[model samples]
Target: MICSSSSSSSRLGWRGAVVVVAALVACRHGQRPMPAPFKLAVFPVQNASGGTAPIRPLTEALDAALGARGLEVVPRGNLDAVLAQHRMRFTGGVDRPMAKVLREELGVDAMLVPTLEQHVADAPPKIAMGVRLVGTGERPVVLWADAVARSGNDAPGLLARGLVTSSGELDRTVVAEVARRVEAYVSKGAAGDSCGDAGRFQPRRVFRAPVLDDVGRRSIAVLPFINDTPRRSASDVILGQFVAQLARSGSFEVLDPGFVREELLGHRIVLEGGVSVDNAMALLSLLNADLVLSGYVRQYVGGQGAPRVEFTAYVLDRRTQELVWSSSSLGEGNDGVFFFGAGRVHTASALSCRMVRGVVDHIVGRRGPLGPAD
Candidate 1:
């Protein structure tokens, strides 16, 4: 897949104000408006500029801009606490499933995700920034998106230009533009024709296995995924995402990973090298589960550019000791109409979420046996 940012003119100061005014006028003409007193959470801006520039300044700027527009902003401390409780980190992309979790945990109406595509502190400071507003709900919706690129006059040793140079000025301008767009979106209550384009970034299922007819409403135990990637925590991150996907699907009763891990540790069983049939059966019996879920992260690569993820998953019938279903999926961090300058982007966590959804949807299909797990 290919990822590209929306092309917006850097000189949007007057244009942004005009848009907001137009939206307010439309509201006066009987158009429904967004409800007042909405709360927003500005997630930590992601650094995808292929550099180590600080992100705190951008995040703080956005937060301040939103607050100045009369929108209630969630405190950074509270947001961080919720993320810590769920063991989640800000990674630029928040899928519908994860968005729902955030809504429940933080009670926020919307989330802002910003990505810094380029930030050069050279003579003529250059910056490219992208921002998206996502509504918190069962299925998150993209409320707005804006991207801008800016650069100052080229000159060697422009350090004499002082700290308040083109870079800082452009940053504030972009933040202000984002804030203006958000206000307009709120006042109009309509996301416009462009909203339909947001689907291009959504995760799509590429494959599906034959439905398992005999599993019925059985409890499932998801073992820790084996990580073949170089990242040491790939397994843990992917496993958590997979379990969350399964839980949200309501396909089978999912056993707690903590409980499953304790049992595995007690049995001195290491699942990194694949589980034998006998050992799988033993573990199934120990957990009193009907099916065992296992997987391997074949590839996981993340960086300043676009992150990519690949994994294979399988479901084994404990009673029959046979592999009932299996599927594999690959997700690219950037994929879409690159020519139009529009593409999906995924962070490591976001890619894992997409991969898990693909695997789970393949196994369970759209409508599966829906009932509380045993």
Candidate 2:
């Protein structure tokens, strides 16, 4: 997940030129008062410094915010397939020139091209972004563009002490700016008639637990999360919160750490150090678990009366060793400063909880029967 920027390219031409002209003309003629809601796609932001950018979180946040504003967002996976088909290589941020190409190639109403200004993981990770909206030939105008920056401590201590941790506001700031632009574009008639045709402008919802039906209960093993952060205690802090939340959900019969360790010991699985995928599988089998969950706490800070935590998780299928569901979350608190930033102003517990829950629901609930309520 190195944060790298794509090499700059010459000004767009051919298809890019055509799209630009059509877009500007539509704006001038005012053929339609308002364009239809749009189908939007986002490419991952690149990090020039080889640092991991908050790619998924910021993208998800933008999707959620835009969805609230009545725009449709195509799923990232699907968007990737479309882009790959067109043989486009997206290196992190989307510059203006790249946006036009993506929009035309993908046949989408708009493409979000972001330029990565900063992607260092320092004490306060620096994750800055510049965004531009590129439209198709029917809507060539570059509807909007914006840039956002955030600084924080505990980024990840990369490339000397220069790259600290990621800032709490980094992802939020990018999402807000993108949301504002999307809203403005729709209001200014850049959206066009696409939205009117529901089939074209609809987001494909990843079905989670649509319903509870003749479901078979599956046991899950929640393994210890690796501490990828610079802080020594960061892993423990995030671990506590994760286990607590999973326990609260009561979705699966959770195997406590003690139980897992004991099982590992009996099977001579070497529990003295970090757990690998094979070790995790052995433990799962011994515990009679169906799935194994593991992740790493990428950043954590709690020295100056304020605490921050950032972590990621993955649900692995024991048999196939495939990552069925994976996600990342960051939580911060001014008052609670420690203990995983519980109950603080900057805490993302509610939102993070929803995200983790969504992953769980997707994995387990999907296997369950779809209910009428869902």
Candidate 3:
């Protein structure tokens, strides 16, 4: 669960990717009970990284790497057959029904969902990948989630030897790094850092309502964001980031996004502007969640020059029906870089990660401005 920066290097765009990889790789993950070894299925890699990046090779590499981790790898044919039978196209996240099918039909214990958030295949290649291991059961539960974003020119070193010239090599470096952490989880029962601890990524500003802290409001569900941006999947990306941060914090039970999507569809809950208090209550009951998180993505601009991301999020208590927490955040790829790209972030995904992570921290850690609810 090593969450590296855009400059992370295996040999690494990134300003100091080489140094980052070495340092972040040493960040020890928290300990958990050793999970019983079970068959794992790697879903087809989803390409939302902008442009038409070929994902088949990436998916193949994950399957091979997981197999090398000593776990049984379910064949692609078996997974495709199940998808065809159900007429489902869930490549990003698994819902409860899909997880049930995978468990009963293919005898899989866990599902690995991977999404490519950023990719610049040209020289000085760049990539940002997010992965989550979901255990199959009554509900699709996230066992672990982590992301690795890196560049090929992180550390040039003497004679520029450390520069990664091959995009293929960069791809494998990131994929292998992520998979290695998965192996670490299955073998040593160690997990990585939570989003709140990523010090530099703290929110630009936050406003928390002066509500009494209650332990009862722990479980949460992040509804689909209201995407005002031009990008079609910006909402999805931010939603996933919020969910990942909540799950990794080990503080709240995050409802599986797939289940949330299914319920929203089943109930015909259309989130045109924001989550209505009534709709929030319905979600609380239907998903058995303590809180519902909703948001609006004002702007999400990626690719080309410095990527920019801006969004606002809020949390509602199911029991009290009160707006417990809320925050507005904005970020740029070069938000905090003061020197020589020392801490410069690249890609919209990386920027959004920091933004979403910060918002999650405010909601759980209660470290933002305090005021009355709107």
Candidate 4:
């Protein structure tokens, strides 16, 4: 009897040990591993400072900074070639749809969109820059963003003198600061409220009218916008941005602008004063489109330090010859700082992009004005 009891005790101990080992292994496997460093594609830095300044040095400086931070950056030449192959102009901005294309084509995990806020070669050499790191997926995310503003006199005499002589030094300093902020954001894994506050610098205005149920599935044609601003090219800039936003929404089948232009020319129909019912019907028949989008650039003013944009849009049903939807947006650029005279300026392109985004969002049934802190 004693021998049998001892054997039973030994077997129970072995069973308990096995259970404990299994539990330990399961625990180890349950923990998620840290993600690998992102394979990043740094797009060409957009020049939004309203000047003819060369942006090559700035782009190189940013690449070097990110490389030092252990990021694998796509080479500039390769990026440029891809852009050319796709017939894409580097507009210093990439909407969600474009980002998806870049991800699939370039095999990049994320894209870096940087804008030159201020790049002056004046005596004190002012420079400001903003950068956004966007993740690529079906739903794009703004993973990180930070802006840097600096004046030559902000640094010591030796450094300030170097900035005056070589803009490369200034670029490096700004890029380094941006890299530092981005690193901190990644390590924390949360942007917190402070990052949310940074969005206050730009505000968005959105308006929406009732849209037809089938608008989402219809093919759309964007006519040439009427240019009311002094700048002859303002209409072209706004039109390109508007089309890009509409395409990004994925709510409509946007027809090719070149095709639309050619068809309009063939019909001898100039949409200068808006589309007449008969003209609209004829054009729709020629293009076999479902809807027509027309807009007028009410305000597109850009100067040394201030840029503003305003536009109104209308959506007409091709079959009914009735206006189905209307939306308008207004935006102004401002440097985020006001107290110490250390603010960053916004460019005309940036303002127009914001306004177009607002209009698109409203048309897609997302009706709400973006707050300052959005």
Candidate 5:
């Protein structure tokens, strides 16, 4: 009876020891799921050229990826109509204060930024995409990110189908990869490791001067260019062409020339010809323009008996009366008559178009208006 009792006690002790060891192993390996205080507002993917249209496909894909991961996505219809109605383009990182305004105004937690840098219509087509996770602040904290994806042709439609097939599935591949990475990060209880931090836009560094915090929206007016050409008709032609080009850039809220002239008649600036920079500034001040661009057609000569022409344009800062930008271009036409197209003016537009773009590049830097912030 004594031996039996001793054996029972020993067996009970061994069982207890095994249970404790199992509990320790479980404690070492098991992990608690990450908390859900984080929310992301994915930005529309910006194209390499910085146009918004080309990124539509990528935006859809990213939305689906985030959705599958149970991350809430702002609906496209909600913001798309708003931006279009307002004619507002999402200004890159330099608009953080503006974005923070948006966060408070729109009630979003974080901003997810994805950019499509390159899209080549190769055999399967290649898509280069980057994703960034940023928090809400005047300067947002970049929390997490994923690598760029090189996908094939069908990648374009990955977001639409909500699933990918085996053949050339770039979008699907990227979305799946991003979800896996984010999930792993959440599992590890890590935060603030951004995937392509260098490229993200931070507004503070981009703007040359302090921007108005949530400035009330204002309209704009575009005045005609003064023509100094020998031909009287040259002035009208140049100014008309300038107006059309500026409209295409989507930068200015060009007031109707006819309306401006009629309004100016009330103020006495419009004479038989256009107004000078002094009067133009007065007119712009009355019109409440943030900036005014006034310039003259310094030279316009169709090459003698040749299909070529020389054109020179100058821009004046309406307030300071300084030459902001100036450009001269010469082009050759086949008919030996100088039109806006041909030599020097490589783009497809009137000579005035080149001048307009040149001035814009100069004002914004040689990198162009939509370039990434320094």
Candidate 6:
């Protein structure tokens, strides 16, 4: 009996026992359920400031800020590795394939795409940025979006006591506000109040709507605007503003531009001059969107002086490719600032957002007449 027992114990020695225990522990850990199905992946900050600005620092700060908010964020290294593996560098929006990759491969639920539109190192630094959260599902949709066009001096209190001097400091401040909004939507599923036609930043004229009011809750695709302005990628900056506004309106499930871009590429579609009816129809069939929003960015410039943004936007029905709404909008930073610089915008990105929101509001019939801080 002793000989038989000794042989059995030798076969399953201490090392085997330890290995069995470790395997059981790992299995237990693997069985533990995840708190939620949603995990956020933040894309690297895109530098659309048209100048050299610190991108890495802002990206790291934003990632850290989101993590501090208790949201599960996929590590930056992991997302970047995936991006490199797939060679996915488009920042306009998350294409469907990229979304699938992030969702299945990396387990990323949503995406936060931030673009620095304008930045200037003045006495009081001015920065304008647009942040958007796009849900990574079958249809990539913008869940929550916000834009900040701010100059430190825009809010200086008595005796210039509250001036923001450093761009880095201002970056964190703006980013924190945005992160708070993102976390709110993530935890409570409620975004901040929409700022539609609230400020002096409004389109000068919004006219001629045939089928605009009827297109509620419909899916819309905003194509890239023609960058006629000298500012590099001005069209992209304004397109982002429209995307942010349209998403914020809660009136339409604005398709992610990256997804739209991917479709356009696959179909070999081109917008030579502007989106023709044929182009719109092709996009309509491909994207299954109710409307297509296309535009031309004539002037989008901001610097030492008042920022100015001018553009024309038109929406066409997907089935008929008939014009639904076509309007031209133009605004300046000091459009209605009458007081001692009380309500003035400092960056083109913010100004464009304001102008675009006004147009979106008018289309949805939610805005009041042109005014200041309504």
Query: How high is each candidate's TM-score?
Result: 0.47, 0.35, 0.83, 0.47, 0.36, 0.84
Q: Tens-digit lDDT track for model 4 on 247-333?
A: 445455455454566567666887767667677778778767778787888887754456677787777787667877776666666
> Ranking by lDDT, best first?
6, 3, 1, 4, 2, 5
> Given candidate 6, what's the lDDT at residue 354?
74
For each candidate, the alpha-carbon lDDT, in order, equals 0.59, 0.47, 0.72, 0.58, 0.42, 0.74
Using lDDT as the measure, which candidate wins?
6
lDDT of 1 by residue, 1-374 (tens): 00010111111123323443444555558554334445678878777555566689888888888888887778889888877877765345554445656667666666776666556565356655556555564334343544544444322234545333556776787678767766655554423221112232333434333445444635677787887877555665556555545544545555545446656867898775876777788889987777888878887775444568778777788766788777676777566536633444424445455556656666676546443222
Residue 226, model 2, lDDT: 77
Candidate 3 lDDT tens digits, 211-247: 5255445567889889898876778778878888877
The better candidate by lDDT, 1 or 3, is 3
lDDT per residue (tens digit) for residues 201-248 in model 6? 666656655556554326789999998988887888878888888776
Off by over 4 Å in 6: 1-37, 193-198, 215-217, 366-374
Candidate 3: regions farther than 4 A off = 1-35, 193-196, 210-212, 366-374
lDDT of the structure predicted as candidate 1? 0.59
Give one digit per residue, the lDDT tens place, for model 2 in 135-166: 44321223334444444543324554643344
Candidates sorted by TM-score, best first: 6, 3, 4, 1, 5, 2
Which residue window of length 10 is worst by lDDT in model 5? 1-10
Summarize candidate 5's per-residue lDDT along 246-306 as a digit string, tens digits.
3333333333343355446567776345446677567666655544444455544432222
Clashes of each: 4, 37, 10, 0, 12, 0
RMSD of 5: 21.6
